[model samples]
Target: MTDTGQPSTAIARAQDSTALACQRMGDGYPLVLLAGQANNHHWWDRVRADFHATHSTITFDMRGTGGSGKPQGPYSTKQFADDVVAVLDHLSIERADVYGTSMGGRVAQWVAARHPARVRRLVLGCTSPGGPHAVERDASVRRALAQADPEAARRALTDLMYTPAWLADHPGPYTTLGDPDMPAHARHGHLVASNGHDAWDALQGITAPTLLLHGDQDRLTPPDNLPLLAARIPRTTSHVFPGARHAYFEECRAEASALVSAFLDEGP
Candidate 1:
């Protein structure tokens, strides 16, 4: 899913934080992008322009994703966070403005909670603080995810993940945005890790400034968790995209990037 239009890049081996494969470009302060499960660093495709002009943007393949190596079983959110730290260490970045989408947000939550010193600021988009307090997946979405046919599953899952109008408007990404090479075990590992995440208590202890972004029409990871996140996390603000869905960052790239850029620029 790496964008062909992206800048020249190289992979780094992060030994300290679980040793995943990472790629970075851009200039200025380090702004690391953590993508969701089932995808790799390439998922950041359409939004790179928003940050690259102003910041040293970074993106990586979490273990079990992209060019990274995957070990056997028992992956957890905190482990994912550690992998993030490894990337920063490998790149010689002391701290970074960390942005996490969907399952990556869970990893970011752990970084902010457990390794607060590593994160300068935090952005959690289209994600949840999984626990008893978190919103449950819709039955339709669950069924779609379980579909046996790969293409059917992709279509069905995207149907839940995107707004109807958004899918119609951005057919390119909707149809072509996928990592065909990601292995089945790796995908399952991420899914298992994502489902196991529970940062309910960890949210309150995050030391960095934080932002939560979500689409009002999102069905997969609904807006229902926003209130809970606001109440738990201190020094946090949020933005809602009217009529947007899970992939609002792409569907409304201009507006979303503007908001994110403004926020990133303001932080020290």
Candidate 2:
């Protein structure tokens, strides 16, 4: 039912027994959507429908999250970057527009640096370059991530990801956190990988046309961090959405997607 002539969803292997599951939509220039930490492909559901209209959009569950392979962590962003490449190779896509958010944004940096030839353009949303140079996570935030109770951790993280107004308005959605379904180990792996990742140095070699979008009120990766990305990557443009938090796409999907779609139209 999809472009691959298979079912709407399919799993592809990158390494031995490590299967990366993905769902494809549209049928034009490929646009690979990499999700954030603790999130699966569903994170992009709202925007994919819009993106699919122009670009063939593919959103995948990163290794160890969602339906993807969950190998042990202590994983690096570079390894996740490799996973993106594997997906492209399996799907026979020579090049793609890469869009990543938060942790996924870090992986996108790696992909641009390591496989510049494969990336047509790059978009980093509400994320950082990482390393000692990158802004560190708040101590209380970090502590919450280490909490034993996963539900409590999710609720705490939601606070950081969403603004107060959004949270107040979306009680029903947020309430699901009490017994929501998510791979704890995969989420843990994401935390481990993110903590270990620092791709600040790699940005120097990025050749793709890049756009960095950050929510002005992002607590997870704040506006202060924008300078790190803007300063390092050559030919990079950025947009800071007012009142938006880490979940910028969710908070401002129409505005965010329009900016991205227009950028993608310009090409490399």
lDDT of 1 by residue, 54-171 (tens): 7877888888877888766667888888888877877888889999988888899998999888888898999899989999779888888788997898887677667778767767
- Evaluated at residue 29, the lDDT of candidate 1 is 85
What is the number of residue pairs that collide in model 1?
Answer: 4
Q: Give the Cα lDDT of each candidate.
A: 0.81, 0.81
- Badly placed stretches (over 4 Å) of model 2 are 1-7, 147-149, 171-184
Candidate 2 residues 77-149, lDDT tens each? 8888888888888888899999999888999999999999999999999888888998876888778856899
lDDT, residue 66, candidate 2? 71
Error of 2 at 24 (Å): 0.6
Flag regions of model 1 displaced more than 4 Å. 1-19, 174-178
Lowest lDDT 10-mer window, candidate 1? 1-10
